[model samples]
Target: MTDLDPFTDLLDYPMYVVTAQADTERAGCLVGFASQCSIQPARFMVWLSKANRTCRVAERADRLAVHLLRRDQGRLARLFGAETGDRTDKFTDAPWHPGPGGSPILDEVPAWFVGRVEKRIDGGDHVGFLLAPETARNLTGSRTPLLTLHDTHDITPGHPAN
Candidate 1:
């Protein structure tokens, strides 16, 4: 197999905070793997590590909210990325409101969308949630620079990828 690490070393793809709600349980995590996979049908996919608590909650969640953080919102990124949800209630410090299907939507994000989980695909260490967007909100007029992986190098993952 060819090494794919080098290909993404210079790429600075935008980061996202993915939140989910199942029953009374809620989980959110900083995600690096997500993208719009379709055009006409308007589909998106977010990959969550199986080891993370958010992935566990997301398994039972009917919907997931993907939030786009601005370049200046690095604190929110660290809050979601560096802390593990297993031992902490991440929502206590972060202000949010129930969104489509009751998924938690961060109030501080520049843009966000709630999508129904259409399918879950097994992808080695991560599970890809295929989403069909139902509701979306954009407050930045699509002009704000988004937080990217390159901006989050200092923080460590709350859960190990493998």
Candidate 2:
């Protein structure tokens, strides 16, 4: 696995904030593993760390919201990436509204979508949540660039990796 570090380190993917709600509990976290897995039916997949609070909440959630941050929104990235929800109220600190399926939509995100959880796949330390997009929007229009892993490389992980 150590041999793969060099190859993996070279990959710089876009980062996202995934939010979930179940009952009265709400959680969100910065995610580095997510992509559009299908085009015909428009399916997306977001992998959440097993150790993350958001992942725990998502286990019972029917839906989740994925948000794309702008390149300039480093502060927002840090808030979600560097602060653990176990000790911090991330939703109260950030401006957001209840979106489709009761997922929290961060106001600062440039683009976002609410997706129904289609399936859950166990992927090592992370669990992949296959999503079927229910609603989507581009708050900052189409030209806005998304923040990538390179843009957030300096930030530390809020949740400990399992």
Candidate 3:
């Protein structure tokens, strides 16, 4: 805390709810480090913290689901953003459905998709998964106010892997 201030630089970018399924179990969390890495093939990469319970379930998953939350869905963000999957069943409180490969996609998000895991790379504290979308759904308008890091000030990671 002497000179390093990650929070100062973390306020930008949109927040997303990432989900995945393995067997009968589904897991997800609010992801900050994700991007559309490829435009030609329309690929996206989402980083899951190693300490996240979702990460563990995703390890054996062949598909993952990603969702975009509205700015007004602050409470939804906190449920997945601040609560620890370690002791909480996130789906119990959120409405969702099994998408491609059985990945649970949140129902209230503006947009959501189930993707096939193309590849995975170890990135120190987190694991990056490259996803090729298999099926997608747009639940809201593109002009919707998306949830951003700035809107999640009241929510803290219940499980900080780092």
Candidate 4:
């Protein structure tokens, strides 16, 4: 195991479903590498795996949508985390609508945001998309329980890590 694994494996990370649209093509995937990076200007970042189809589409996209699923939405998490867009139409099975910049906003999520892609950073096996929030929604007035890495241990990623 890598040195980082010892510390990293002890923590559970929140998961998100990130979607991107470029031209007529749409793609999305379950991501664990995301967080708010700024407050004054309000910026968030999501890291897309280089091996996933979502990264390809996100590369050409002007915006992206990030969705937070409830604790009970394990089925939706499995759909995005274990399924590959290369051979599967994930949107066909889920409910969604077009948001700002034509990003797909999953209808089942409790909280979400559409962000303009401000920059892309190449970080090893993942590409980090830095976003400036354009719009955000919180369907639940209170904090909702979220799905996390600890809850998705059984899902085998649809693509290679590298």
Candidate 5:
């Protein structure tokens, strides 16, 4: 696995913020492991770390909101990435609205989607959440570039490592 680290580190992928709400609890966190797994049926998967507060909320959430930040939105990224939800109310620190299934939709994101959680797959320290988009909004035009993992390399994880 150590040998693969060098290869994986060379890949520059987009980063995202995934939000979930279950009952009265709401949580969100920065995620780098997400991708469109299918094209025909339009399926997307986002991996949440087992140690993240968002993962706990997402376990019981019926739907989740996925947000794409602009390249310049590093502040928004850090808010979710560098601060733990356990001690901080991330929703209060940012502007958002209750989206479908009660997921918080961050107002500053360039694009976002509310998806129904169809399946959950355990993958080592992270769990892959398979989502089917119920609704999507592109706040910015297609020309807007998104933030990538390379752009957020300096951020430290808000959640403690397990």
Candidate 6:
């Protein structure tokens, strides 16, 4: 194994809670590895660990909804970020609606986007879901501090190696 802990240096990266749905089954997880990959096509990529319950649901998902949560929503982040969807219904406690491919769009989020999964690449432990921005909208709110990797460093991963 590598001696360096990549996570130790991830403090500066932004974090987000990403949600997806396939029919009646829905799931969400707090993700740290996501970013824009293309400038011309505006493609964004979200890496889901193979062990995550959300990854199971995402296999059949046609679209995914990504959200940016504010710092005040740490509890919300914990619900999705610190808890495994395999044992908990994270959506039951939040407000959501169906979006592209029947994916759930959380209303409590500060901003959201519905993207079509154009390609999925197997990247060893995690798979990258490349999304083409189908639609995006910003919620009305004052500029608020976003939840960051540093803010969640103390919390254990919702889905650890299994």
lDDT of 2 at 55: 92
How would you encode candidate 3's per-residue C-alpha lDDT over 1-162 as one tens digit per residue?
Answer: 525567557457899999888888778899988999998898999999999989999999999999999999998999998998888999999998777777897888889887899999999999999999888888765679999988987787988637
- Taking the tens digit of each residue's C-alpha lDDT, what string does model 2 give over 1-162? 588888989998989999999999999999999999999899999999998899999999999999999999898899999999999999888999999878999998889999999999999999999999999998765677779999998998887755
Off by over 4 Å in 4: none
Tens-digit lDDT string for candidate 6 (138-162): 8865666888888877778887843
RMSD of each: 1.4, 1.2, 2.0, 0.8, 1.2, 2.0
The TM-score measured for candidate 2 stands at 0.96
TM-score of each: 0.97, 0.96, 0.92, 0.98, 0.96, 0.91
Instruction: Answer with 5 or 6, whichever has the higher TM-score.
Output: 5
CA error at residue 63 for candidate 2, angstroms: 0.4
Minimal lDDT window, size 10, model 1: 1-10
lDDT of 5 at 14: 91
| Candidate with the greatest TM-score versus the true structure | 4
Range of the 10 consecutive residues with the lowest summed lDDT in candidate 2? 138-147
Model 4 scores a TM of: 0.98
Model 1 has an lDDT value of: 0.94
Expressed as tens digits, the lDDT of each residue in 49-90 for candidate 5 is 998889999999999999999999999999999999999998
Residue lDDT tens for model 1, 33-76: 99999998999999999999999999999999999999898889
Candidate 2 clashes between residue pairs 3 or more apart in a chain or in different chains: none
What's the true lDDT of residue 59 in model 5? 93
Query: What local distance difference test score does each model get?
Result: 0.94, 0.92, 0.88, 0.95, 0.92, 0.85
Question: Model 4 over residues 10-52: C-alpha lDDT tens digits?
Answer: 9888999999999999999999999999999999999999999
Q: For candidate 2, what is the lDDT?
A: 0.92
Q: Which ten residues in a row have the lowest lDDT in candidate 6?
A: 1-10
